[model samples]
Target: MAETDREIKDSLVRAGRPDRVEGRHVNMPVELGSTMVFDTLAAFEAARAERYRSGTLYYNRYGNAASFKLETALATLEGASAVTLTSSGVAAITLTLMALTAPGTHLLVADNVYGNTRAFCDGVLAGQNVEVEYFDPMIGGRISALFRPNTAAIMFEAPGSGTFEVCDAPAIAEACRAHGVTSVFDGTWATPVFCRPLSLGVDVLVYSASKYISGHSDCMLGVVACSDADLAMRIRKHVMAVGDKTGGQEVMLVLRGLRTLDVRMKAIDAAGRRIADWFAGQPQVKRLLHPAFESCPGHEFWKRDYSGAAGLFGVIFHPCADDDVRAFVDALRHFGIGVSWGGYESLVLPVRPVRTAQRWDEPGPLIRFNIGLEDTQSLIDDLDAALPLMNTGLEA
Candidate 1:
């Protein structure tokens, strides 16, 4: 019988138990090794042949038992045919692009994607002679107009990293399918808990497990889940060629984080929504860029497809000096100023939207908030105390 996602997640925690030492271990043991031994030359040769044919573990760089356990759990969660775990999120993106695009291939990317991704496209991919184009995040079905015969892939990110502009992922995915263009979605914002891109017709789903999957600020990991077996194999081959394998200890940490992901996501979501509602009433705020809110771009698409929202969103402050913006962020006591979200600690960061193919003309300074597992009232109080800083030299 088919189990629910929650059930699958829970079952995975104890699914692949190690062989009984006394009785049975509740979790898969971390098998750290660089080489595998066989009883005879015949067995060793057979294993080598099998590894070449199936791409199984012949070396640690290929992946260990612990990494495979986490990969299995993530693949099942995403409802993907296969998964490739990489050293980091950017590595996953790099590997996926390397596997799919060759020289002279055109790749269409959402304009509001993570800044580093755009840098990768501009720097590395362009250096290799790949044509990169950035389109509006809200383009939806119109994305097809930008495709050419040589267009190899479309990179998408719903509720784009800093601006919180949601994209019509399903519409875009359908358009890509019609044109035979591969679709790669950055699912880090929603993870698999709130949104499943594979079900929405995305060919590849990439995630920065460094954030929500780790659920802590420690380990760095990334995962690429593919609905197409051919693409999955290609990505795996690229990863192997690049020697991009996550550490066993880091994989175990991510596995531990997955165990509590459901509850943590719900708690963080509730806190974020509550804070966003509060921000809506603040006079200094020009607009709230949250997908669950009406003012966010492509909100209708979010409402139509997503089951829930995540803890990250943006706040566009009413026209204020850059100094005031700095003061507001610096005054916050509870929220740390840093990049990356989905951890247990609240964070705030000043963001300046950067676009080449499109214009981001918000009338005021933008600040992104990452709600964390702190007391709601304390967080609200912190914001209330800091918001006055936005008006700080103006009243004089």
Candidate 2:
């Protein structure tokens, strides 16, 4: 059977793990340290030369057995040529952007990208003299018209940050290939479970593992999975140069999370869809921002490209008083008002995406929800109670 035909869920448990040895345990042991001593002078020199190579355990920053294993497993799952683990999601985005573009090069970014990552383009990349340009997330293949001679890479997030807008990725990838520009994608929302960006013709797929891959919301990690060996090597060299490292303990945690990702992702997918549909029928909700819904921009592309939807999505509410919005948020008993999502616990936050390329003249008071593994009715009931609060101010 073809690799695609094989059960990916089974691979989640077995990939990157060695076959069981009679005397050894099933899971690989996590190793922690900075330095490794070699017995022979020749061996030490050889190991030092090969330190930058994957799984070469000469130094802690380079990576250990666990790090290599996680990288291998993630690469296999994503159908990527190689993988690079970084200290944080910000590092992964910055490093890829830094490595791809230089002082004179140009970058095309989606206006609705993660605000934190978008700031780097304005700040650090600006300091480095790289020209950064933001474009409408709905531009689709028309993005080709904006490419300049100095254009190096285009980084975008599908089902974008804060406001969920799915860009036309296959079209964008085609444009990149024609223009000889690199395409970097933030595939955190879909991951490898719901969607694989590499298979969609994207060059690099970066993810924030702190959210779902770590599963428990305890690990702070970023991952880069690339299709091109040369490009992957360039990013890896930059990672080494920056002395960025992901601890073995975090790798173990991520691996543990990966074991159940198939089940959790699907469950969350189902729950989020049900809730997103529920929000659409509410009197206060002006529009649903879910990519799977027909009302969402580029929903057609999402249908054509992605295998399924992720738990993260947004809901736009009709004009509401500030006090009422607060009452609605405060009224929720189960949903946590938090920054990040993709944990076992559900999260809710009011979102106002600052867009430069396009006007975000949607309905007032957009609320984003990250559905968790909670009981469907309980969450719906929690929202059902809160929906009334959007009209009535918080009781004094």
Candidate 3:
């Protein structure tokens, strides 16, 4: 049995050794092989039979020693009993959903979840008769009222995309536990370094290892960590059933990234806060939607739960024309226009708030910014030059 969350976390923090691998000193090496050879017929049979149980590894698709090592590291960090890796973040989430719910089960998700996630719920899960109801990201404790008899789980994103509304995760988790429903939080933003969702009562924690974990944006991977052994088994079964396995190269990349995650995260936190402060003072920026900012929704919850904020955050542009955004993008020198973030370089992207039946009046156009390791002065300079280029902001 695992010890307390603190003890588990300490073990995880100490397990990351980028320079050492398989008793070798190579910094990085691909554990590429679809098959694993057994010592004898009985060993092969035993491996085959033990495939369904924990502590046994058969093939790469099921899980290899390297994969399990990475999983253990993640589980240790998140204070989880076990973890499952997938080819992509979407696969991790999809497998988790399938493992946790049946065809008739219902799910409550934040309206502001990732676009692809919403698509999965509406297009795939809904088609299979799994009812998904969208809830306000700021619903907080009131989320309990939305629970139905068939509700199986609640999926939430902290500081949800486009609009940076941080949800009260503890309140939501408490409500879920009271009703015998499981809760999953997309911990891609905080990772284990910043926030420990399992410690905060979250049943399952998921992450896009492709982002901060990989750090280089060259590989794609996902991690699903769970505290319950039974739930972990279900997740693993679903992962294997769906053929959702990450490549050894990606796993190695994530391992390499883990070695430097602490240093990178600290740099990101400092630069991100400085950028958020800069945006707060900008005339063209109407609202700085970073959790560190006082005006951010659920700021108190974030301050209480999160050890630090990462690079990603949003800023609402003062009411301006679309052409102004075009000019601003063209003027930017350092910030690249892209979708994925958490890399060494900075990125910016225009995002339209996903409007639902509940549409609150937003102030202006929104742009999500992922501040990188670049010098604060240089990033500020780039933004300063781009602000006046907004054609729509010329007069009105």
Candidate 4:
């Protein structure tokens, strides 16, 4: 179709388009649009049916070319039939749970999921009269024993949030399939570069792209990957109804991140192992909660399923006064003190595990470290310097 006189005059200016070009852009152009104008009534009707879920040019709320391109990249990564982009990481998880469940729905969630996830289950899901049960993250094939007749979905996120306990996801996924239950997984800690949850038989894979995928901590994004077309469509419709949308700029940020995901993950994996090993050898460190280390719970399963480990890990310092532990963290020079991780700068966070299925009986201070694109030796030096501060009061 030829450009209309209006397009030739002001449409290019309205689009913020570059000078008229005959060649293609190396990057996916960020086409900002909301109101889509169809040339004719026939074209409009055809679009409402044929192009609705296909991510073609339609209304912006459903999805646009920019968001769909990013979704396609993620779907390709995780071996999923479809991917839905969301506003934030938590939104992706919450939306999936809401879409697949209802009042009286029996939902099984891993006890070690992110605190935000647990809050949603405890507050929103429970308020709606949904039956929410928390199971051990390492329950594995035994998870089937907890499933009820009305069990609608089971959610799991591994390299467990604050505790760093990896889940035997394949076993749980297999059980979900046998019982005809939806399995939702969050592998944000280990993006598709290190792990692909869908191929492990999980029904839906939810991930936060804000961390490792964005690589620079500038974008807030989330994704849901589903291989079953019907299941994908159901979730997509729910997302549309709720008016959840991923902005074109945010999707573009993720697209930029993907160009280097594999190489970046490789570097992060090496640096993480180095730091975890250093922590393991420290006399003040009682336990290393790293997936690649044998001391970490579910390390065997991680080795079996994952191609690499995320740079994030947990450490428990041997009995030290709470003040001394705070002093130790305060004395760190290279690592930033923050809650979120998986960016270019290293971060250290004091974290405590909250569990109901299992008791956290360890008598020590727990801290999480996210080793970023930093010099391993410098990180080790910083850790080494901070270790003595933890023992300042104990040694006396």
**Highest TM-score model number:** 2
Candidate rank order under TM-score: 2, 1, 3, 4
Q: Write the per-residue lDDT of candidate 3 for residues 184-289, one digit (tens) a residue.
A: 9888987777888888888988879988878888989988988888988888888888787788888888988887787788899998999899778777777888
Residue-wise C-alpha lDDT for candidate 2, range 197-271, written one tens digit per residue: 888889999989998888888888899989888899899999999889898788888888888888898899899
* TM-score: model 1 vs. ground truth: 0.94
lDDT per residue, candidate 1, 1-396, as tens digits?
Answer: 114666655654553345458975556655677887778988878766655223366668777667777777777778888888999999888889888899999999998989889999999999999999999888889999999999999898988988988888989999999999999999999877788889889999998999987899898999999988888888888888888778877877888887777788889889999999999988888889998999898899889878788999999887888888888889899999898888999999999998887888877888899999999999999999889889723332
Better of 2 and 4 by lDDT: 2
**Which is better, 3 or 4, measured by TM-score?**
3
Tens-place lDDT per residue, model 4, 1-396, is: 003333222321222222346785645677688899999998888788855485677798888777777776677667788888889889999999999999999999999999999999999999998999999888899999999999999989988998988888989999999999999999899887677788888999998899998888888898988989899888888877789888888877777777667678889999999999988877788889999999999999899988889999999888878888789889988899987778889999888889887788988899999999988899999988878989733332
User: Candidate 4, clashing residue pairs?
Assistant: none
lDDT of each: 0.85, 0.86, 0.82, 0.84
lDDT for 75 (candidate 1):
76
Instruction: Give the TM-scores of the predictions, in the order they appear.
Output: 0.94, 0.96, 0.93, 0.92
- RMSD per candidate (Å) reads 2.3, 2.4, 2.7, 7.5
Clash pairs, candidate 1, are none
lDDT of 4: 0.84
